[model samples]
Target: MNWLKSGFELSFRIRPVGIALAALYAITCWATWRLSVDQFFLPAGIRVAALLLCPPRLWPYLILGEYAYFAQMRYPMIEAYGLGWVILASACLMPAVALIIHLHRKAMEATTEGWLLSVAASAALVASALKLGLSHLLWPAPPSMPFYSNAALFVLGDYIAILTVAPLALLWMRRRSGYDWSVWRLPPTLAALCSLCVLGALIALVGAHDPMARALLQLLLVLPVIALTCMHGWRGAAVGVPLMNLMLSVTMPTTGLPSSFDQTTFFTQQIIAITSTALLALGSRITHHYHQQARPAMEVSQAIAFSRSAHLANERDLRERALGLRRIADDIEAALGETAHLLRANGHEGPATDLLRTFSSRSQQFRELTSRVYPTELEHAGLYVALQAGGLREAWDSSHRLVRPLLAGDPCQLSMGLQLAAYRLLAEAVLLLLEEEKGQILIRARCGRSGGQLGIVFTVALLDRHSTLTPATQGLAIERLSARANAYSGAVQCRTNRIRIMMRDTPLDSAWLAPPRDVSYSSETSARH
Candidate 1:
């Protein structure tokens, strides 16, 4: 069963499991025969599906299974036609059909959207056409078997059979494990099956012989299929189509089916084939959309991974280096301070004062060197304090550029990762403004809990006092700010010279530590400056 299982490519070869394969094919032939009605030839579908799913080697086993089935169930009919008639039909029918499908086998197995549907249609055509010709080879057909209608009926039946069965076959073969099924009530599959049972019983007993009533019942059958398609995508159609076919088959007696071909039944078969194909295609599109939407989460992870992992570890290393540098600087400063006191004690006041000034400046320079690596002040003082009291504010203020600070909420709510991101965002915004050299940059930041998530909103408004800071310049700066904002899954909005950004942390106390999203900046890498 596993070797002959769905998705196992069948090749032409002699295998030890010939008997078991023969048995499997025989069972398949028998089941398809039982399910088929006039113009709904399921056996043709099975033959084609087996060809497509299995390898060429196992095809001989299928042929043997077909012969066994014909001998076991169809021998009586062949006996009436005599040995010569039997031999001709048996040799020509399935073997010819198999050979034809094998020839176009590569085309049907293509990666196109048609997939099994194409196989079903092609196989049904070849099988039905071959069977029709073989049916007339030995003798004239019965009076009841009119040629044109019978030919049309034969092809439609096989085509319908494939549409109904092949999807279910493909679904089983590619079924994924750990699928999240609804835990409440009955599972959708069992529920759908039970619904079909009840529907079949109602249609059979309702005595709706009129066209209007029958039409209503048929419409009822289609609604469930649409509903299932919506609920589970193409997978839903795979399950629902087979069930509808079963119901339509069960209630077929009311309309006198399995009797002969007529206008109503022929049209009904065509409609079923067309609609089922449409639904399966639509379902595939829906499945693709859902997968596309989930990819952003993966994008978000990749974007922030380097920042959180390497950058943060690098920050720690810088801090340690800073401490070592500061210790060395402090020792020299202490030595200078001691030496300055001795000189002043020895009546050299001017020399002692200059040395004291040199040591003080050298210590501050060491702090500046360390800050370049990891913003050491930002670590100890947090974001608002770093912006308000640190060298960032002092440097610009000394250059006659004003940075007006407006900060709110508890800074402690943000994790170290987010706090660092906020500092970078603010620092970069100020740097852009400072480049203009003539604008008042109003820096505004607020940290607060929004529902479950703690978040920060940072806005920098450029109060331009010159014609040089044009609209284009503000747009370019906004673009840079947005790149950083977007990488953290934040929302960015700009109006005039003001750009506002909102980024959230995970709910509860820990910051939203999900990795940075790389996709956000994919389109705006030029703005990273």
Candidate 2:
């Protein structure tokens, strides 16, 4: 028994492929059953044979099981009755059932419960009617017999059996194997199983105690089972549907069986089967709707998680960079003081004193700029003033042709970190153009309301030849700009020859602008020429 269980477990572990194959086997068994008990049992033997021999080509065997079942039962019966008439009838019925199942399977994949229910229900109704019509026309025997009461009875019995037995068997084989549908089939197997169970249970409940009460109960059961399948997966439905059906069957009345050829009783069964099928489809549709909605919510949650992780990583990198800047500032400040003292003590005359004075002043300025870029000082004052203090805009206005604040509105309300980022981006852009010997660089900074959000646009355009700027220059500026923008929940991008930076509206903390500690650094040996 343990070995048998282990083997079964292995078979089910193949996921959707296993589930799909099991469903195919179930279909073949049912088709075989249509012929005779032996025909039904034969497919089971064939399944095992394929399992041992050519597992990869198991689908052909499954299809062949259907063919074999029909050839043995329906075809032979037709031949024994009258070759022309029987063959024609079997040809019509067998193909029709096969086609119905195929179409139903496709519909089930696309729609969920609705299409499944529709296909199953319609098949039950149509097949039941056809069976009764065929029996009366060709193989009719005694009236008042339970099996021959009417077309409705035939429809009811077949519908009940397929809806109940097929779903249970399929769900069992699929769930016991513990498989996910992702590996093989397109549609979710759990979803299909849920739909089946819900319909089965519904029929079992509603039809309880009635002559075809079992069929009604199964139909009713499928409604909720489909819903449960959507939530808990097909496994729940697989277990639930069959359990409910068995319960209903055990509880169902066995008082007076209807005669097989009684048209009224048969027709009544058909009505119940058809109605149940329709209801199941409706329930399945509702389940599918919920599934569709769930996917987007899941995607949104994943995207948010990714964004948060990225932000945290960026913050870590920036924090490390800030620490480095702090050390550089301290060194530069010490260097500036030393340079000033050297000039004074050496009794340096005009030219030497002047040069030392200039170097000392610039060194102090560079220290200030570094602090603004790396610390919360810029974060406090916001981007506009940070640039002004950093000498980014002042430097541009002094050395270049255009440095202008395009639109002045309420000072942007944003975090100090964002302001620092914006300041650095502008500084980088201006510096790149200077390297190209570009005479005119238009730097425009604006803050205002747009799209119900605070909008900030910083643009730099070269007045000189567009080709003057190298790719390396543009790329560096963009990298710096983008780094800053992303930190603030904004983005920076370059289009054509212009860089565009935008920031969304956010509340600003007024205290952020308060003066903060400055990092002084040594830069005498490293000073640029």
Candidate 3:
């Protein structure tokens, strides 16, 4: 009869892989029932994996296949009509499992660890309960085991099957779909060593008759599984767990069934389930930690790249503006020369003389404005020479004490943008002090290394005790200087009667800069005094 049953199953394969999987599941169900040390079932994991991996449309075929297999397996144990009842009950159970999986599809599909196990366990328990209930109501006589004991066995077997086998099935399906598996590969030598250690431990435990020795051996099994999980993440857990189960099955003796429930086997199965869950959770956590660590570094690198790009764009724009201004200045100078020559030739000597003088004055102003826009002198001679020659001290009269030199730096080492920013900051600060009529202003400029980057600082101090320049009165100067300084990733600070501008020697690239706000006085102002 068993031979016929086996032959029938072997002949039941369909061409489609889904059908093939179902046939394989049915064969496993029969094999485990007959060959397992206890009455453990192993079909729940295959059923859940099939439902998850295959589309919903193909589920009915899988259910039908499972039902056919279940009915065939029960044929020898029950009457022909009773077989109908058994098949009907199985038919109902298969769909119930499918329906539960459908309801919790999101949880089943999550990449995290606990979701699959939790859903599978819940479905197993509920399906087992429903089957036991139907049996009690429909069967003519009570089964050999009491109702609760039978139900417990059913739930344990189903849940264990799902926990042990479902992850492997999921991984196999993922591989078929061309998912990347490189992250899960461990060094071949290390994996073989760990496997051997676990196998040896299990073999030793098999010979031990004491329950405590077996328990200790079971605990020892967790170490290699943990090592594998650490090495390869959840994929490691998936592989290591099933290997341990296979080893346990082979090493442990399969003698006569326990007169009562096999408490030792049940305890070992429970321990295995707990170990699998822990390993999976650990792997998931390690993956999450690596992701978290990588994110901030990536963000900073992108920011630096973006800043450099923006600086290049701004430099290009400024170069175009300088060319346009130079052309306009040349045209105005030529026109003025022609107009003066025409007047002189027409014998209007007095008017031509005045006109020439006026043209010269306006030409000088134009040259200054052009320099402010893009300083050719600063570009060529460096920041110090440009400031000394740029008329900053001349802007202030004898009414205010003139600070001799207001700029410092190795102009060749500095970028064009940095040079321009420093020149503008000093120019703006001197203009502010002149406009405010601040007497005896002391201007100091210094350049040095700061925080691994070259930096420049300009300090403008009002020496007159009567000078009363508050933040409110100096708002316009502060705003203009701050905006210009920020364009080069620099800062301007205005304290009582004094202002300081500081900047990194590196040229700014990012467009983002804080707008000018009310300046708070610092102790540095008093220290400078």
Q: Which segments of model 2 are wrong by more than 4 Å?
A: 1-60, 67-94, 104-106, 109-111, 129-148, 165-239, 250-279, 289-529
Q: After superposition, how far is residue 438 of candidate 2 from its true place, in Å?
A: 40
Model 3 spans > 4 angstroms off: 1-40, 108-111, 172-197, 200-215, 230-233, 255-263, 285-529
For candidate 1, write residues 336-413 as lDDT tens digits.
Answer: 888988999999999998887876786666566556445667768777777776656656577566656789987776
Report the C-alpha lDDT of model 3 over 173-270, residue by residue, as the tens digit.
Answer: 55764435674454762765466466557566554556566656766777777777777666677777766665555555444322113456566767
RMSD in order of candidates = 13.9, 21.2, 17.6
What local lDDT does model 3 show for residue 373? 61
Positional deviation of 356 in candidate 1, in angstroms? 9.9
Clashes of 1: 17
* Candidate-wise lDDT, in order: 0.64, 0.49, 0.64
Better of 2 and 3 by TM-score: 3
Report clashes for each candidate as comma-separated counts.
17, 61, 0
TM-score of each: 0.69, 0.41, 0.52
